[model samples]
Structures are given as structure tokens and as C-alpha cells.
Target: MARPFLYRCPITGNNVQGLTSDDAAAEGEKSRLEMVQCLACGGFHLVDPAKGPLPPVDDK
Candidate 1:
């Protein structure tokens, strides 16, 4: 089993459990397990461990 990821919501400070790579891809056509929504403040964020923060992505 893969390790669990940890994420805290900036808006509400509530921690959210992250999804694994396999589980994330199993969400169907609209796979959206990358970032989870904050239960308290309704915010969304990523939980990447390698870079500490979400990596920079460019859409060009």
C-alpha cells in the first residue's frame, strides 16, 4: 500500500486525507482526487510530499 498524504486547508486549517495515485485515477472520466475540498472553508489544495508544496505547472 502507498503512504498516506497529509494536507491542511489554508482557509480553515482543517486537515484532509489525500488519495493515492491508483485511487485517484479510478475516479472515472473526471478524475479529481489530486486536490480535495476543505470541509470547513470549502477550499481546494494539493498534497504533494516531494516538493512540500504543489509543483509548478505551465499550460502552454
Candidate 2:
């Protein structure tokens, strides 16, 4: 089952949410690389799930 992951876009600096593989979800606490497609920049980046998925931004 896929799980949610989060990362910051290097190009856009947007806190984006993404899904991870079943294996990755099982090891979410571990340091592993997850490639996230940035919603703000439309670029691909590799980020560690351990470091982020920062708290929900207050857009208001």
C-alpha cells in the first residue's frame, strides 16, 4: 500500500505532498530517498522522507 510523504521543492521551495511505495511506507522512519514531483515547479527531486513533510502551511 502506498503512503503519503512530503518534501520541499528545490526549485520552488514549496512543501509538496507525495506518496511512497509500500516498502518505503514500512520504513518511513528510516532515512531513504524519495523522488517527489514538485507541484509548484513541475520538476523532479530526490528528498529524504525523514527530514520533511513539514507541517501544514498556513496559507491564510
Pick by TM-score: which candidate is best? 2
TM-score of each: 0.39, 0.63
**Which 10-residue window in model 1 sums to the lowest lDDT?**
49-58
User: Cα RMSD for candidate 2?
Assistant: 5.1
Clash totals for all candidate models: 0, 0
- Kindly provide the TM-score of model 1 when superposed on the true structure, using C-alpha atoms: 0.39
lDDT of 1 by residue, 1-60 (tens): 655565665655555555445443443454244565555577666545333334334446
- Please give me the total number of clashing residue pairs in predicted model 2: 0
Ten residues in a row with the worst lDDT in model 2? Answer: 22-31
For model 1, how many clashes?
Answer: 0
* Model 1 CA deviation exceeding 4 Å by range: 1-3, 22-34, 50-60
* Candidate 1 C-alpha error for residue 21, in Å: 0.4
Model 2 pairs in collision: none
**Candidate 2: which stretches are off by over 4 Å?**
24-30, 54-60
